[model samples]
Target: MFFLKDLPTRQMLQTYHERYPGMNAEAVAEALRLLRRGSLLMRALEAYFTAHTLSQTRFLVLIVIDREPGQEGLLASAIADRLDISRPVVTETVKALVQAGLLGSVPAPGDGRAKRLTLTLAGRAVLADLLPGYFALIADFMAREGDGTA
Candidate 1:
C-alpha cells in the first residue's frame, strides 16, 4: 500500500504482518519508533489538558478565551466564533468545564443574553502541573525528530 516510494513510511509499514515473509524488520522497527513519537504527542497534549482539569477541547476554549481581544474573554457564542466550530460545540465544551470548576461563566453585563468565561485557580494549578510533562514529551519528540539520535 506504499505510494511514491518503494518503501512505506514507518507508520504505514505497520499494517503488513503475516503476508510478507522476510520483510524488513527495520521497517517495522522504524514504524514502531514513529508510532511512539506520535503517541508521545497525544500523551503530552492529553496530560496537559487533564492535569489542568480540562479535556483537549476545553483547554483550547480556555486558550481562546484567555487570548480574546479584551483579555476579559467572550460569551459562549463568541467563543464559538473564535473556535471556527458550531455554537452547540462551544455550548457543550463550556458546560462541561463549568461543571468541573475549571471554568466559570458570567453574564456579559451588556448583552444580557451572553455569558463570559474565565479559568478558576484550581484549573490554573492543574495546567501548571501538566506543563512540565507536556514540555518533556515535546522535548523528547523534537529530539527524536530533529536528530537521528534515536
Candidate 2:
C-alpha cells in the first residue's frame, strides 16, 4: 500500500529537482497522486469486503470459481496461477472456506492428488447476497475516473 497519505507538493518536487537533475516534478507529482488514489480505492474495497465478512483474498477465491462455467470446479494451483496471490495464501484461504462450509473440494478425475475447488451452496448464497452492493461500489469508483471526481 502507498503509505504516504499526503503527496509531496509540486514546489517541494521542484526544489528537489534542483538537487537531482533528472527529477521531472510534474510527472512525479502526477504519478504519486495516481498511486495514492489507487491505494485509497483498494482500502475502500477491503473495507467493503470486511463488512461483508470476507477478506480480499477469500473474496477473490470465491469470484474466480464463481466465474467459471459448469459443475466441475478449478484446481487450487489454477486458482493460484490466475490470481496475483501466492500459492500458500490461496491454499490457506481454500482450507478456511471449506471449513466454513462456503467451499467444496473433490479430487480431480485424472489426478487424484490434486483437488478441484468449487463453491458450496452457502458460498453461492453469500455471493448472491453481496455481489449487488459490491458491483455498485465498484461502479461508483470507476465512474469517478471519467468525471474527475476521483
Candidate 3:
C-alpha cells in the first residue's frame, strides 16, 4: 500500500531493481538523502558567507591558511592539494583574498616560483566572529536530526 507521494520513488526503485537484480534500493535511498542534506547545508553556508562579503571558496582558502602550523603560510599548490580543489580556482581565490586584505603572501623560501599564503589579522577576525555561529548551526542541525525533528 504505497502512498501517492511514495509512488514515484517506489517505481524508480523497482525499475532499478529490474535492470540490476543486485541493486539495493535502501542504499540508493540513503545515498540520495545524504546528498540532499549536503546540498541544503551548502546552500545555507553559502548564504552565510555572502552576508560576510565572502564566497565559499574564499572562506575555505582563508581557513586553510589560518590553520597552517606555526601560522607559516602555505604555497598555493599545497593549499590546492589540502583542500582537494583545482589549482586555478585556488589561485584566483588567493588573489581575491589578497586584494581584500584578508590574506597576505610572500615568496616561498628557496622557491623563486612559489608564493606562500597566510591569513591576515582581518581574516582571523572575520573567521573568529563567524565560527561560533557556524558551529552552533551545525550542532543544532545535528541535534534536530538525531531527534528526528529535522
TM-score of 3: 0.85
TM-score for each model: 0.60, 0.88, 0.85
lDDT head-to-head 1 vs 2, winner: 2
* Per-candidate local distance difference test: 0.69, 0.87, 0.80
Best by lDDT: 2
Candidate 1, superposed: residue stretches over 4 Å from native: 1-40, 47-53, 69-71, 147-150
Residue 117 local lDDT, model 1: 83
Runs in model 2 deviating more than 4 A are: 142-150
Residue 56 error, candidate 1, Å: 1.6
Q: For model 1, where is the 10-residue window of minimal lDDT? A: 1-10
lDDT of 2 at 68: 89
Arrange candidates by lDDT, highest first: which order? Answer: 2, 3, 1
Candidate 1: tens digits of C-alpha lDDT, residues 11-85: 555455445766786866666556665665676677766665566677778777656566466778767777778
**Model 3 bad stretches (over 4 Å):** 1-8, 145-150
What local lDDT does model 2 show for residue 126?
Answer: 91
